[model samples]
Target: MASIGPNEIFFLLQGLKWTVALTLIGFIGGGVFGLLVALARTADHKLARRITAGYIAVFQGTPLLMQLFVVYYGVALIGLDIDAWLAVAIAFTLHASAFLGEIWRGGIQAVPKGQTEAAKALGLHYPSIMKDVILPQAFKIALPATIGFLVQLIKGTSLAAIVGFVELSRAGQIVSNQTFRPLTVFALVGLIYFLICWPLSLWGARQEARLQTASR
Candidate 1:
């Protein structure tokens, strides 16, 4: 068995970089689409609500690994050559969108009905009410849940390895194979993941606590 060295460590760090990149891509892309989904879910029209609800259900109901497989391989069957990076990005974005949309929808609903009524009473249009009044409060309410989801998204990036994406988990696998050190390699991998996620989890908890205190 080969000894673990700086080279293995560096390679793992490289994988960590891609993992962070994928997480960011997923979170940012998801956040944009998710906001729209949240709005649609809470819309006045039944059609819009139904459509977005269906969108959320399909994504949330399915496994993310399946989603990645469909995006990575399904496109190839149709003669579209997609890169693993792009495919994983798309899958994660869609996955994150469904989850974050639901989180934000709850936030939007949590705002007092009086707030929307007051805005409407002031001759505000739907867009104006949401943009100026409802969204700000909803954003604050959703921040903790959003961060918690972000931690999940970070760990979920490991699934990209299934699609041949070279991420942190994949890197650990490669190193473990080369060095014949599965335990050491995976221990480091777990440590890195913990380092990345634990703080966010703590922060989310703290925010939740603060929100509760504020509400009380």
Candidate 2:
């Protein structure tokens, strides 16, 4: 069997770009959709809140793997032509949106009731108050949580490998199969993931600390 060398490592690093691309696609798409969902849930109307909650429930309640599989097969069953990357991106966005929606909703709710009362006392409309006062504050609290969610988002992109989206995990598997060194190849992949994720985790923790300090 041929041993891994610099060329193989370089090949693996090329796969990292796809992983990062998927992570970016997932985060941006999920964040925008999630913000809308969070905003709906935070709206004054009961119907809006209930609808958003149901969306979250369905996405969060089901397994993400199943969601991916359903999209893959379901699209084909419907005679729709979809590529693996597109399928994975859609699945990731759907899954991430639910969790991020819930996280932002909690942040919105956590803003003190007194803040709302004060906004009303100032002759502000609900939208004006939310836009000018409450949401700004809520976003401050949401920052750390959002950052924390980003770490998970990066890691979650690995699931794309399931549907033949040759990301980091899929790249590792390819290398191992070619080299016949599963343990070594996978261990290196794990190390690469750790290198990527550890800094984000630390940064998120620091952001959480700063927000808490500012809160106090």
Candidate 3:
């Protein structure tokens, strides 16, 4: 068996860049769409709430890998010339948006009912209430959960490999096949993922603590 060498390490590092890029793309796209979903879920209109709830249920109830597969192939079947990277980015954005929407919806609901009442008393309409009074507090409540989900999103990018994206996990598989050292290659992969995720976890924890302290 060949030993894991600098070349193998370098290839994995290259894959890491794609993984990070996918994560950022998914998170930014998802966050924007999720905010809209959250607002729809929290709206007074029953039709909007029902539609958003169904969307969330479909995404959250399914596996992300299957979502990627469907998106990759379905687009092709429909005559779109999308690549694996684009498919993965699209699938991950939808998945992240669902979970993030639910998290933010919870945060929005967690705000005191009286706050909404007071905003209404001041003649603030739905948009004004949400923008000026509700969203600010809900954002603080959502920050920890948002960051926590972000770390999960990073790890989830590994699923992109199944759709032929060749991200970090896929890179480990490639190096392992070449070097015939699956254990060493995967251990390094795990370490790299840990290195990426641990700080986000810690930051989420720190934010949670700070928010709690401020609330108290």
Q: Which pairs of residues clash in candidate 3, taking residues 3 or more apart in a chain or in different chains?
A: none
Each candidate: what lDDT? Answer: 0.96, 0.87, 0.93
lDDT of 1 at 125: 96
Per-candidate RMSD vs. true structure? 0.9, 1.7, 1.4
TM-score of 3: 0.94
Q: Assess the local accuracy of residue 211 in candidate 3 as a C-alpha lDDT between 0 and 100.
A: 90
* lDDT score, candidate 2: 0.87
Better of 1 and 3 by TM-score: 1
Report lDDT (Cα) of residue 27, candidate 1: 99
Query: lDDT value for candidate 1?
Result: 0.96
**Predictions ranked by lDDT, top down?**
1, 3, 2
lDDT of 1 at 121: 92
Q: Model 3: which ten-residue window has the lowest total lDDT?
A: 1-10
Q: List ranges where model 1 is wrong by over 4 Å.
A: none
Candidate 3 lDDT by residue in tens digits, 161-212: 9888999999999999998999999999999999999999999999999999
Instruction: Specify the highest-lDDT model's number.
Output: 1
Q: Report clash pairs, candidate 1.
A: none
lDDT (10s digit) by residue, model 1, range 90-203? 999999999999999999999999999999999999989999999999999999999999999999999999989999999999999999999999999999999999999999
Superposition error at 156 for model 1 (Å): 0.6
In candidate 2, what residue range of length 10 has the lowest lDDT sum?
Answer: 151-160
